[model samples]
Target: MKQIVTHADPDLDAIVSAWIAQDFLFQAHASEVLFVSRKVPEKFMQSADCLVDVGNRYEPENYRFDHKPPAFENRNSTCATRLIWEYLLDIGVAVRHLEGLVEITYQGDTHRNSEALKQSRIDGPHAKLKQLKAEYKDPTEIYQQMAFWLRSYTKNL
Candidate 1:
């Protein structure tokens, strides 16, 4: 199985991004897209092709931002959500329907620069994970109501 992996205790961005990636993979990869939200088990990382996130604690080349220029890192302090959305857009996924979701959550990234987010207070409680549960009304319902908002260019990613 191919893996769409996120950092340990994945936050909102990581979880949402992983779900989006899974949807995109369904359009391409034939096998199941395993959403690895914690440190990837060795079996998956070693046996499967892995796509990882900014907080990826895994040491692997599939990492998307390992060699980002220092300036870029400074400007965009967090990864996962923003990176995933941009990657989806770049790869031609239908994420034109989800841009707003990406931006609203990015604010949490700035908060991450200074504080330690916790589940009760996690690392990126916004960027990092605290628990796994549904936080939206319903994705299908959301898409129906806000597809236009996401498609519009309020600001650049």
Candidate 2:
């Protein structure tokens, strides 16, 4: 089994990142995958063949790298969504499918502060995500819908 491990105590951002990474693996590698959302033991991290979202953190010795940009490489960006999206993009995954998620994370990490939200111009994508979050709808619903689509798409290929 392939395990995609999220950061310890993952939030929505982490979950969304995991969802995308999971899909990328399914399409590019194989469909049998599981995402581990808990605080994974270092023992498990060392032992399993897993993809991890360990941002600005230590790299597990055994897992082969598909693509992981170093933290110093992109200081302006926060959150795993951008990192995961960029990695997928490099590997030829159509991450436009995840624009909504990508956007909201940008908003949450950048403009979510009181001062930034007060500014007249939030970036268009982030602004749209802000509006979506305002509606009190679960963001997971969108990713779930995409997961279904990606599964069928992968199987067809």
Find the candidate with the highest lDDT and give its number: 2
> Runs in model 1 with CA error above 4 Å?
28-48, 54-72, 75-78, 112-157
Task: List model 2 lDDT by residue over 1-157, tens digit each.
Answer: 4656555433345545556656664446653333343444666556555444552443323432222245335433455666567666776767766655565555565445444333413643334334445653553543344456445543433
Q: How high is the CA lDDT of each candidate model?
A: 0.45, 0.49
Off by over 4 Å in 2: 28-40, 51-76, 110-157
RMSD of each: 8.8, 7.5
TM-score (C-alpha) between model 2 and the true structure: 0.51
